[model samples]
Target chain A: MSAPIQLRPDETFILNVGPQHPATHGVLRVKMEMDGEYIVKAETVLGYVHRMHEKMGENRTYAQYLPNLSRLDYLGALGYTHGHVLSIERAAGIEVPERAEYIRAITVELNRVASHLFWFGAFVMDLGGFSPLMYAIQDREHILDILEGVTGSRLTYCYYRFGGLYNDVDDEFIEATKRFIPNMRKSLKKYAALVTGNIIFHKRLEGIAPVSAETCRKYGATGPVARGSGINFDVRKNEPYSVYSDFDFDVPVYQEGDSLARYKVRMDEIEQSLRIIEQGLAKLPAGPIMTEKKPKNIKLPVGDFYQAVETARGSFGIRIVSDGDKNAYRLKLRSPTYSNMHLFDETCEGMLIMDALAFMGSLDLVIPEMDR
Target chain B: MGGYFSDIFYGGKSLLVGLSITFREFFKPTVTVQYPYQTIKMSARFRGHIELLADDTGSPKCVACGMCQRACPSSCISLDSVSVDIEVDGKVKKKKVLSRYDLNFTTCSLCGQCVENCNFGAIDFSKEYNLASTRKEDFHFDLLDRLKRLEEKKA
Candidate 1:
């Protein structure tokens, strides 16, 4: 496409890593200029899975756009939905009930753990560990069942309404969630022993494809990628959205900034997420789930409102500009993966193909979300 | 030589630990439900394709307000209503009754907007999940006919 950008001498051959490769995860294509095994220049080609989510938001009413947020990141659907719902709530000035906020926090944290488990499995699989994927997916199914009990639909959950949750969690859901926490902690221990402590995993990742904190900042790489590079900037702690401020959880930061460091950050985040879920369950107040006052028709008061939340990947920001209409004048979804994926171009320069691929996995690229 | 030997020892030990973890889990019963022979119970809040609800007298409950038709983002739902004379307390009165409620299931996002927007509890999600079909036109659900079919099956 466009004559390969006129490669200069000494760049060697060009290696393309799929607009449709398993290792690339989703429909992401990386154009890597290679000299035998070492990559000279890497350019990530996107927009393969772009469904124009922002454009779709403009075409539909604010309430109807709820389902579209989940499609952005299926692995962390609730977090995106939570961010969108918060922005809509802010725009319409709808007050969310205390119980609703607690439920939102609990579900969002659950989703974060699920996303990390999937990443852990897939990342390990990328490094030639097959059994961990089985172990990880098996554990992940439990979390899905627990979520599906309350939210319905396993992947693209459209459970959150404009004001609060679409429906209240049943007693069985709460009990199962409480039971799942300790079990997941046990699973984490197994994962640590299975993958984290394994020599092969360390050998493949540690000190390989090192991304400096400066590089992360340059690319605006938030979430585990930034946290891996010793950046203490989680939107949960830094910005403090929803009921995240109420929970006492530490942001795990590693200075190594390698693939292993990002791995450790995500693993530690699962523990922190578990801690948040437990606290949320314990302090869940008994009150109205939805706000008593019905929200008025969504008409933004001729201003732009931005709401940001800590998704599993990073901080997902939603910007809504309404020209006093039921539909948004302009809706911009600031996907975290887009910024994270941009790091691949600069970071993967002059690295081995395998190590760069490993580094890409560590970034946890959801191609659809990036393209969105 | 000492560092090399120790590195070998620790790496071997971690590998053994990983093996042991898998070994213990191997004895556990499989989590996968045997499909074709078994099916998981659908949740109450499970959002499936929208279906029409029936009143106690085996009549369609839809008042045909057209809120769901308007509220749907994809515009997958198409409602057709007809006004007919009905005997009411020794008097003839014209009443709006649902003729057809068609859902283009391929375009349906299962968003629950139709169910939420409806003032009367005349529509709900049918727990028909394992919807595998070859033809695209097969998904075009006529809820009125589906309701009568369900009623006959129940009887």
Candidate 2:
């Protein structure tokens, strides 16, 4: 549909891309000023799925707010849960067991792989390749199976507690994770052969929508999007939390800053996740999963506390303001996709509508995460 | 002419390589589990919904502590209990007996907060996941009656 706007006397039109369009990944509407197929300017309208999670945090106790973390990013729910738990633990001075830290690392990395797999499928599907989505989901189901074995739910897992996990993972979970790493490696090789080397896919993506490192810094785009622009800033390595410093892995970075570069960064991150999972499995200690002296009732000191963790998309930050009460005085969630999506207004200018959609896919937005 | 033909040859080779990968996977077993007709078994830890756990004496282990009701984020669980006089160790003692236990599955997040805070191990998640119903009333369940029926069936 065309909206009558007085941009020029020539053939200039306005188009609305979503709020309901399947290509949007969620309920996100992008208004574009288009001359034929090119986007002159683009603006994103948000708050479609906002459920006031921050207000809910102020109403409920810290423990009760655990389930809301999963609702933020269903694809990588554990990372948000981990962030919330770590922030509260730091504020309350709770010590987590070493084994529980290792378990958290392993499960979070497994969730990262699953998130990237879903993105891989959806990104290709956005590019009009249908077969890769089915293949990617098939691989992702294995990760879900391993996670469901211990976390009790596959997606939107409310598994982690303040000091440790709710339940200790069984030997079968370890065995399943050990089996998954090599299987995932074999699948990565297959994906390289199938999708990466295709000329048509490369032609559409390579050297298109190059975001400079400065733009990333301005927008606070941290994950693979920033990494694609050769910004080697990952929260895990920079501000090492949990047992992340124990694992030896590489953060993949590409200098091209194109859609393909971002795509390659995520593809390579999958391999690094597999490496982290393998190392975590080997280093998993035999001990209590939870700390012995956890507080029955959680009340933080009268101060502001913040925790940031690297999720599948980018850095996920949680800020809690407490007056030493059962409920939070104020809670703020800084989601990665929200920051990453902001760059669209600056980046989509002078690009074709098709390439703009591809660029959106490359950013890997989970709309609920952004809206929340 | 030579450069154009060479480009075509390179493209064809890459296309063939891509096709070969797909062709190899085409012969492999399909990954789909064909749901409903051929259901895959859920894992042991699959969280479906909250259910009251029955004790060895064929009654709910819940002491009517009201802890789960208070701890629930959505206010989905409600229990009605009355104090009754019972003989314990040759003495008259007043005990709280559960009259009604209502769990609104429609609003429940299955976050296991109720199960975790129960302390008495009186509640756990049931593995009944195929919960499609035509009527909205089917979701609101009376757990005390369900627990009694379960205990009777066990006996």
Candidate 3:
């Protein structure tokens, strides 16, 4: 070396955002390298909330392992459970009844709507708006009441069995759901007028951390993240698992991949989900809720099986490898938040700290799900 | 300058729209329920802690099958059975009677696996939501003893 190079003081500094910060939502830390108010690099430090769910899955029987999927994403727990149940059902070659399929489709769509509504409240709260959360939860209570009346729990509903639902939804459940659809529509209208056109929301989100379609594909961001960037891909539409193919609905796509684009995508998704629920309720057939002669023990065939479902966050996939034993040989959970959070490392670079936080919130991260 | 004024106008319009909704809702009845003094009723299917159901003769209906113990993900349940003498056709016969049923409530996830596994309908969910205690021992419950005491009190 010719000489020691002198570096200027205060040129850059490392900011520990949190394994404890409120903006992080959970035990997630961002070791961000900062130059003044802007981020030079942001590396997400996960595993603070890791429970090694995959290892747990391999050791336990399918019945024992079913509830673990719901804990991964409590805001939209049913979708992850659905993926796992679907995979195990495919492996075992169990024939889920048409009535069960229709009920599952309706409940899953209702769950998606509940998830997006909660996210809207939480996302706004992250940006310092509190009233929206109150309003959102107030509306979401109707859904919880309806589901709880049938499933017996609010969040983390382990409602679906391997072949069908645990029990049937009563006529009261149908009446409540039918009454809720129009009321939720009115709430959505109010939300649009209140927050969508607000100048403060516009300034905070519009054109901030613009993620292009290429970036989304490179990072494997699905659901609203990809749809926000004009990628016309949705697991429900493209793959058409369950009775989704029977319903006619539009997958909303926004050309702009900014935070606002993601926001608009989720809002529009709520509408589509509502439409699916409407159709499902109308076509709710009469039959047995469960298949006769249910197997006492579940032993999947010696092979790998997978199923993917569109959760509120993104596409959640569950893959299982069975050795023809009661327990799975290997279980892999492909959580959407894990891939979605990785986009932060590249996309959040050079963004203002505030904007970075807003962008992080827009991703709708569930840190435990990502870590698990 | 024109664009700035139009933006402000639209922003104000949106603000008024939000304010109007809030203003009209001020007259509506409050939704918050007061805890302790006022309580919401639990749904018919509300899942809580596992409870041992009683038979017509005021004894536990459990036959000590151990299906629940095997099916529990957390291994939170343990039970013991004893041979009891009974008269059948005026002759002494041996039958298994449930002697102990312990529940490790600390590890219980309230998944309702025990209820589903029971073919005899010996268990159900008890609507015990106000569970709070300091000592760990309070959580480890002897279901057989509790059932006996409950039956005695009812009698």
- Choose the strongest candidate by DockQ: 1
Model 3 regions lying over 4 Å from their true place? A1-10
| lDDT string, candidate 3, A1-372, tens digits | 699866687578899999999889899999999998999999999989999999999999998997888899988888888888788788888888888888888888888899899989988888888888888999899999888888888898888888887889999899999999999999999899778877788889999989989999999999898899999999998898887889999999999999999999999999999999999999999998777867568998888888989888888898888899999998998999899998999999999999999999999998989998
TM-score of chain B taken alone, every candidate: 0.94, 0.90, 0.95
**True contacts reproduced, candidate 3:** 0.65
lDDT per residue, candidate 1, A201-245, as tens digits?
989998997889999899899999999999989999998878888
Candidate 1 per-residue lDDT over residues B65-138, each given as its tens digit: 89999989899999989999999999999999888889999998888889988889999988888898999999
Error of 3 at B124 (Å): 0.9
How well does model 1 score by local distance difference test?
Answer: 0.90
How accurately is candidate 1 docked according to DockQ? 0.79
| Candidate ordering by DockQ (highest first) | 1, 2, 3
In angstroms and one decimal each, the interface RMSD of every candidate reads 1.0, 1.0, 1.1
TM-scores of chain A, one for each prediction: 0.96, 0.97, 0.97
Candidate 2 per-residue lDDT over residues A191-295, each given as its tens digit: 887889877788789998999999999999989999999999899999999999999999999999999999999999999999999999998999998899766
Let me know the TM-score candidate 1 reaches against the reference structure: 0.97
A-chain TM-score, model 2: 0.97
Query: All candidates' lDDT scores?
Result: 0.90, 0.92, 0.90
